[model samples]
Target: MSSKVIHAIYTDDDLLMQAVKQTREANYHIEEVYTPFPVHGLDKAMGLAPTRLAITSFLYGLVGLSVAISMMNFIMIQDWPQDIGGKPSFSFLENLPAFVPIMFELTVFFAAHLMVITFYMRSKLWPFKQAENPDVRTTDDHFLMEVSVGKHNVKDMSKFLSDTGALEVNLINK
Candidate 1:
């Protein structure tokens, strides 16, 4: 059986938000929403779970810190044992202050770069990836809301979207 979906387009973000709320209230299953830019509170409005990127970033930072510490201990205290500014060359504890800047920079670098990579991977965004958006206008100024039509009437769904301030509504068979 072919799947049917309704695409509701809105010109303004506010209208899109209201339409989403109205659609949910009317018991329509919203498949997705596409916007030109990030919309504040859109996830909450859509009842999506909070992201865990911050926790992953912290873990990446910890890994970076551990690598920095191990690398510094091996290079400075164990392998080469450089004597700079009359500081102790054989003890990592005594020379930790000198490694603080490197540790901090590496931690920040890992957190930032790894977080970006994780986001890209999680979002399925990669070089030369084809766009999945159904409407190209959604990448510009339009906001598109997709509603799944399992057993709902198509005309009723279109009217509901129009009533909720949709600029245009189209039905698609997928």
Candidate 2:
């Protein structure tokens, strides 16, 4: 099935931000936004719900910390129990200072790596996936806001977007 989408092009990020706010106030459903660089607070301006990636990252870090603790306990306390430089490893708590570096490093490693994987998976991005960019200019120095045209006058929407500082507006059927 074919539907209509409006692509409003803006030259400035500030203009795009204002347009997004105004569009939301007018109750238009914004489909997507493409910008050359990250815009501050654009997600909130678009009324998008907060992401839960931070929670996932915290959980991953906890898992990493626990793994590090168990590994260090088994290695330095139970398995070998080395007596390096007279700093005996008889108890895990007494020798915890030696395990701090490994624990910190492993926690950071797991959090960063797992967060990357989770973000890519959640965004459905991977090698060989086709791009869905609507305009090439948006990758360079332009910003594009895609809004769905559902039961609204195309001319009015185009004019409204233009008045909101769009350099150009194009109607796409997909």
- Against the true structure, whose TM-score is highest? 1
Every model's TM-score: 0.95, 0.93
Kindly list the per-residue Cα lDDT of model 1 for residues 33-103, writing each as its tens digit.
99999999889888788999999999999999998999999999888987688876888887878889999
lDDT of each: 0.92, 0.95
Q: Provide backbone clash counts, one per model.
A: 0, 0
Q: Which stretches of candidate 2 lie above 4 Å from their native place?
A: none
Instruction: List candidate 1 stretches off by more than 4 Å.
Output: none
Evaluate residue 148 in candidate 2 and report its C-alpha lDDT on the 0 to 100 scale.
98
Q: What's the lDDT for candidate 1?
A: 0.92
lDDT of 2 by residue, 111-155 (tens): 989999999999999989998889999899999999999999999
